[model samples]
Target chain A: MSILVSNLSKLYGDAKAVNNISFEVHSGEILGFLGPNGAGKTTTMRIITCYLSPNAGSVKVEGRDIQTESFEVRKLVGYLPEQNPLYLDMNVLEYLEYAAQLQGVTKLMIPRRMKEMVDVCGLGEMKHKDIGQLSKGYRQRVGLAAAMIHDPRVLILDEPTSGLDPNQIVEIRSLIRNLGKQKTVVLSTHILPEVQATCNRVIIISRGKIVADGPIEDLQRNLHGGEKIILEVEVPGGQSFEMVSVQVRSIPAIETISLVEERDGVKKLSVETSNATDIRKDLFQLCVQKGWGLLELHREKTSLEEIFRQLTAH
Target chain B: MKFANIKYIFQKELRSFFNSPVAYIVIVVFLVILGWFFTSNLFIANISSMRTVFEMTPFLLLFFAPAVTMRLISEEKKSGTLELLITKPVREYEIITGKFLAAWALYFLTLMPTLVYYISISVIGKLDLGPVIGGYLGLMFVGAVFLAVSVFGSSITENQVVAFIVSFLIVFGLFMLDKVLFYLPSTLASTLEYISVDYHFSNIARGVIDSRDMIYYASSVGFSLFLGTVVLQKRRWS
Candidate 1:
């Protein structure tokens, strides 16, 4: 495992911020740390990064204990905080160069390493701009570049793309996906579509605890209950409309049938199935025997948003 | 971990002070007011030493040092950059020390230009070099203590304004105790005066380098920095 957290807990006065949370991430895996506001995702990331010590638990990065050997653990991890902490007075190149030096990149390698990061994070156009002058998206890119300057084995980002335009969001998501191909990336965000587009595994956190953890497909399947089938039938006159509805609902796995609309005397029916069963074959057979004109038939898969709401809702 | 890395962070922080208007504004205001006070009270009074400037330094520090340090950790906390710094393989001490040294360097720079007063006194009057050196040393010591207190205040809050107010209150409280001690019983007043930061500063400003005075200033700075470290640790758990 690239990262291991066991029963980690943090308390603020009488309130618990992270309550006995445990999870692990393997090398080269991008794990989406999903949570609503105040769900302890940021707190948990802080603990793993060794910014805050856990009240009772252990975090190990590359077999090194974070509590006992914090400096060593820090050397193996790069963290981008939620608010994009940066010294606005400094220009982009200057800031990244400073980060590189602090990360102990050899003096001789500083130029080469900084250039590589600038290119990788697409910071060429704004390299000389003062951070305060850049737009929100550019500032976020600068923060990401700062994190990757050290080239650590693990990357932990908290709300990496919290406030960006739609175009910037796509750019950052693609950048994170590219980084995940070579490094272990653990990031938390409330944006569900970003997870579906970027992460392979998702961990849903709610109220300081993990409620669900698995592949995206598994989560969707578990929350959706069954497949959804839509059927379009041409029914001349209103005589065949009732019959078609009854016939579609009569199938064993077909749970409900709703008529979407009647356009030019063609009836559209939506069928919900019980499980993973595919009823299209049976419907095709019935249509052939009854000479019912079948215009269109397709299945509608469950989306990640529906699954995410199901997991995170209180 | 490496000396080179510490130096890197230290240099970057020091350079950043000059890269903006904030540092220039602080230095200009500090030198103008301090110079005006020194000339009006010391030079105009025909005093042969820097006693007036040295005497008012702790009070000036009650406000000036906080302005320098209020944003050190507080701004980092506000921007969410403290986490980035902590995860960069740098020890906590290195981070704190680098920032402390940067603030101290700027403080020292603000003090350096005031030496023209020393040069002017030497040229125009019969001066005692011993007390003059002693007064500068005492001022630097008191400034260090104030810097530590201000840094600690910054570590505890994310708002720079709150940090400034908190640090000012602490430093002002320490100075006020010296004057308030006169009203207490003899023994209690003497004991309280001994613990007062200004009392030791006065003794050293008079060209007396007592061992007890040195220990008092060192201990104050050490204790405050230790508390600041504890504050950072507690913030993590909370």
Candidate 2:
């Protein structure tokens, strides 16, 4: 089973909110939809969830055309909008039950399913409390619980962990990871760590188009394949600077070296290499031969933030 | 279109309306003002009929019905709940109807307390039950039409106040159209008056349950509600 979108375009007035973009998510995969604000992340999710229709495109869920068989698509998909979109007056159990009934769950299965969601989402404590009285984190859990109550095959969550504490964020991420084992999950968020923590694949969208789409590890490896090194040198005299610079440049693998800071006759240099090459050993040996005192040496990996910025800057 | 889904949505909307203070405030304010109008103007003035109450109802409905329906779709749009509601397996018409039915039911409840005016008129004088019942039916039919228009207005905007104002203008315009047509030539005025909602309502108010009048109000409501559904559909595309 899979979700396929081809040449999907949404135009609001003269502006194309979602340009001709396409991708697919297979069953039992967590696809991260990453984008900046107004980058059509929510719009794409809305179209997949049948909240909005695309102006030009075809959306197929499990090989069924969403335009012609929206009811069936909706039955298979559970959508959690960005704002949570819950009735604050309803308690957790009541809201879930309402969602279950709306999704065509049989009366007999409501109780069992409700219990399962309550337990899985950790809403047992807040099940009796009104949604408005619950904290933002608990409310987010309730939104997730509502989406899962009907046991749909696909789950689309928009910014699920937004406005949550770090602890709650981790807990929700773990819960999503557990869900990904069985359901095809599409999670949209601007928070990079949530995608790295939970999603198996990432689709980075920018300016209403897909910029990058692949497994997270592959994206990290392909986009930024390098181990950066930071070197702090304690020179006995000014003569050590010219020698260290000449020796560091002679190594063809070193991409660039920049002086970060120099104080008290100690110069800190940031050295970069192409692809996960370990230049720390090369730099250490060169420094020792030149009789230069090596104060500190470390390797730095390219962070997800840099990759996200590079992919979505346009 | 599922029965269970519609019922669930209906119950949820009802519970929400009751849980908030807005519904109670609206209902109480309607009853109090209607009660005062009936007692001070009709009873103390020694009028034996509900003519004064019925006469004042159309004007009262001009403001009150829109207030009841202004937030039905607008508030959902503002709060982003419309996305959640639409993503369910239920059809768009089901959501619209569920909210409309809830607001209509609340409006019907607000009308119930006014029945005391009917009873009081009957006790104090030899009441003409036919015209009074006819007037109440006309009031309800007109109110339903106004509610439909207000719901349509609410669906078009995210601001409840704007919805209220737009609906009020539409309802007031329809009410005044019949009188405004008098300045036109006889032939033109006759045709325009027939299309006016107030003209058909007055026909029903006078104890004449004309099929044409009933059809007019029914079609007005149906037409407005259909427009609301179309507006919502267009918004998705937009």
Per-residue lDDT of candidate 1, residues B177-235 (tens digit): 78998689998988888778899988988889999999998898888887887776666
Instruction: Give fnat for candidates 1, 2 and onward, in order.
Output: 0.90, 0.90
Query: Candidate 1 lDDT, tens digit per residue, A107-208?
Result: 898899889988988899999999999999999999999888878889999999889999999999999999999999999999898899899999999888
lDDT score for candidate 2 against the true structure: 0.86
Q: Which DockQ values do the candidates obtain, in the order shown?
A: 0.72, 0.71
Provide the global lDDT of candidate 1 against the true structure. Answer: 0.86
For A1-314, candidate 2 gives per-residue lDDT tens digits of: 58999999998888999999999999999999998999999999999988889999989998888889998999999899988888888888888988899888999999999999999998888899999899999999999998988999999999999999999999999999999999999999998988999999999999999999998877877887776788998887674556667778987788878888888889998888876777778788888887889999997656778889988775
Model 2 alpha-carbon drift over 4 Å, by segment: A225-271, A274-299, B1-4, B43-47
